[model samples]
Target: MPIALLLAVPLTRAPYILSFSFLLLIYLTLAESYDVLSGYSGYMNLGHVCFFAIGGYTLAVIVTKFSSFPLALAFLLSPLSATIFALFISYPLFRLRGAYFAIASLALGILLYYIFVNPSFDWLAGGMRGLMINTSENRSIISYYLAVSIAIIAILTHYSIPKTKLGLALLAIKDNEDVAKTFGIAPYRAKTQALVISASIAGFAGGVYVYGIGYVNPLTVLNTEILLTPVVMTLIGGTGIYSGPLTGAVLLMIIQEVLWVKITHFHLFIYGLILVLVGLFMPGGLLRQTQIQKIITRLKG
Candidate 1:
């Protein structure tokens, strides 16, 4: 799939499609990472994008301050930095259940955005002025490759979860944490690990994104769209499996790109319409369409 995407980049030779694919890849990673927690573990993290910003800002700081660092090291450090932050916050955040946890995460993200945007914090981050990272002539190509790599990693992580004890514990907890605890599955441990993994992937994606954009501001890196779009994509795709988020991201990106070219203000309306229709009839997502299931069954048969 990655190879096909890479090959298609040049074969089509259309600059806009390449841009669309870049957006698609970024959202695909975000959606899949969100699914690791919200979909499989049934924990809605409304502020999943915080980790993305963490990674982005971390990369920006590193690359900006220490210009001699290897690009690969900067990329690796971004997600690692986010994962470290995730570990610190997971314990306290996981204590709350349902809406409380969701709201807390949302608040945390907003708080970070405002704090970083403050001029007083310019020493830590760039505040309102933001930071611009050095870029190369082939920066776009590099960003695309990095985005593709992270998206693949996110998908692999999703696929791998169901195969491990941690994944089983997550699934068990998703169904019922109390029951999972009774089964000797450590819910706290599993939840923390899930959060860490989810955050790390998001951070990695953010680092790539900052490199792509050539700048990182609080608003640009930590936007509400980043926080919400993954939720929408995960819900639309089918939460139970890996392909669901990918499907959701691809479809939505295409729709947004195609429509925005014709009707500049149609994306949100279309999202609302899709959500409404999904809520009315296809809550299980496109992967769960009756025909899709039947075809899968027959193919396996």
Candidate 2:
């Protein structure tokens, strides 16, 4: 698939297809990261995009202010910065549960959005004007590889977790926090670690995205689509399965492309419809179907 994508880049006259492919890769990483916390550990983090925003902003600030800085250094520090922010907030945020936690995450995202856009922070965050990355011939290709690496990491982490002790503890916590606690599992530790891991992956992807796109504004970098799309893709493909996010990202992205070609302005409307239908007819998600599950099992075996 990756080879096909690379080949398609120069073969096709339309350059936007490559753009869409990059987005698909980004979504795959984001979806997998969300599944780690919200799917496996069962924490709905609406503010997850804040980490993505932070990573992109981190890299953007460095590149914009210091043109001579090494790109590798910027990328490294971006996700690291996100991890620090995640650790600082994880303990207090994890204390909330269910709807309250969801609300808190939403509030946190909004707060960060305003912080970046506010006039007071213009010197630091670039305010509404935001940051512009220098464009280059290899930028898209570089972005593609960076996103691919992160996507691989996200999926592999998701796949390996279910086979480990931490995975079992996370599943137990997801199924019943109190019961997991009774079994001597530290719920706070497990959840916080998962959140940090999720945030870190998302941050890395965001950095890749900004690099590819060649610009970063608060509205674009901190878009809520980052939050909703991952959750929707994860749920549609079936949470708790390692490949669910990958399938969901592929299926939904293709659907979105089709919609964009056909309806254009109404693509978002159709996206919402697809999400509703998935919720109504297939609560467990498309991949959880018996036939599909069997095929996946055989392939894995």
Candidate 3:
């Protein structure tokens, strides 16, 4: 990958490469989080951005109010706050199923948006005005490094979880709840673990995002588009494997960069059309098709 980047640098230039790399890191982290709940646990969390927003807001408030703290401490607080928020809601949320769960999550996100917009909480989040980070050219480079590190950490964490008992239990529950219970796997506990971990990763990604963008508004955090990017990336790339999100993010980023410039207003229309076509023909996603064929060949052998 480094060698490929080195060769492409002449054609792409350093700044564009750096910028896309930053976004790629963010996408990779967030996509892994999405897959833990949606792919592994079969829980559709449409409002996953709520956790991300919480992390961004938490970091913004902490860094803005207590600027004296070490940067590392501030970053930790962001995801910690998000994790706490996830834990607080997970019990009640775990009760809902299918479309109900998805709708409830979406509602929670909208509620957070309203709370952020409220005059009473205006001071907390700068209300609609948004929170701004103290910036420097050096800080930007530091943020890019932070994003890359977080992405790598998220990927490692994601893969490691599935090797643990809790991870296996979650997969068991995902396949069949009654069978998992017969084997003594607590379905609710496994689901909550996946949800909390996914939310925390997203929270960390949100922190990196705010640091990079240097601004945060409720609109930025609560936007449906922001929520869908990771989902679409996961589906397009394939969700059942660890590398799927990374592949999807890279592919989507390239397509967006290439076509977005040519069709600014109708870019989403084109994207949607492509998605429809992919769904009709690919079904199991681009990567899954290859995997399915390989499995069939092996079975025949």
Candidate 4:
């Protein structure tokens, strides 16, 4: 029913609604993807958005370099590039754990942001100028549908993971890595798998995002705020649960819209305050609240 409503959203012909829905779905995709790795595996990777930036830039570069290249192929390459990068860095990144791992991951994002924004790389990445695509009039509609499909896929992936062998391995590692290793679970293998999958989904979603906007820039795709959206959303919604990111994305987006319109001057301050409040009062996330849990249980039943 929710998906049906999303499908019907384009029919409303309201640009603002479409735009809002698109951004919501994109963040939803990112949040779910981030949860798959950090939430499940207990690895708090701050650089996950690097995959997203890579994806957007991958398509941007392909289109800009080979103007005649098939857009579909370019779109597909987005996730591939991200997955490859994940595979390349998985081993080294997995070697570190906890705060060390997180800081390293964040450094990766900052490095990429500077690389893309630096004028020295202008010949390839367009530097601070950014890259633009020639999109059709119906580009927004197509992007919306792509985002919806990808978001659904991310949701399903997050849901199915906990039921799979990989999911159990991750849970075990999350609880106690040394004990998981004793049980024949390869920590690196499982974590790498989660990271790759997470990167791929975020990459594809990033592609859809840049395509929809018809342009890409370092700040737009690789900014600190953009990188943190998924983490914040997942934390707000409830990590380690499939429904958490969805709930977070919806609730945060609504709050953001309201704040943007009603309190433009201090919206960021208000937003940060709200996040702090959530952290202090609902540390386990909004969904983990006993009342909310009861509601969910009744609905499930």
Best lDDT among the predictions, by candidate number: 4
TM-score, predicted candidate 3 vs. hidden true structure? 0.89
**Quick one: how many clashes does candidate 4 have?**
0
Can you write out model 1's per-residue Cα lDDT over 54-164, one digit (the tens) per residue? Answer: 999988999999998898899999999999989989988999998999999899989889989998999879888899988888888789878888898999999888898
Candidate 2, lDDT over the whole model: 0.85
* Residue 37 displacement in candidate 3 (angstroms): 1.9
User: In model 2, what is the error at residue 75, expressed in angstroms?
Assistant: 0.7
Q: Residues 49-141, candidate 3, lDDT per residue (tens digit)?
A: 888899888878877878887878888988888899999999989898788988998788788889998889877899899899887566657
Off by over 4 Å in 1: 7-13, 298-301
Clashing residue pairs for model 4: none
Per model, state how many residue pairs clash: 0, 0, 0, 0
What lDDT does each candidate get?
A: 0.87, 0.85, 0.80, 0.93
Which has the better TM-score: candidate 2, or candidate 3? 2
Candidate RMSDs in Å, in order, are: 1.9, 2.4, 3.3, 1.1
Please write out the lDDT profile of model 4 over residues 1-301, one tens digit for every residue. Answer: 9989999999999999999999999999999999999999889988989999999999989988899999999989999999999999998899998999999999999999999988899998999889998878899999999999999999999999999999999999999999999999999999999999999999999899999999999999888878788888988999999999999999999989988888749877887898789889987788889998999899999
lDDT of 2 by residue, 1-301 (tens): 9656655564574668778878988889888888888888777887888888888899988998998999999999888888999999998898999989989988998889889999999987779989888887888778877887898899998898888888888999989999999999999998888888888998898899889899899888676765578878887898888889889999988987788888848776777888789989887778998888899799999
By TM-score, the better pick of 3 and 4 is 4
Query: In candidate 1, how many Å is residue 25 off?
Result: 0.7
Q: How big is the positional error of residue 282 in model 1, measured in Å on the Cα after superposition?
A: 3.0
Shift in Å, residue 183, candidate 1? 1.4
Off by over 4 Å in 3: 1-13, 290-301
- Which stretch of 10 consecutive residues in model 3 shows the poorest summed lDDT? 3-12
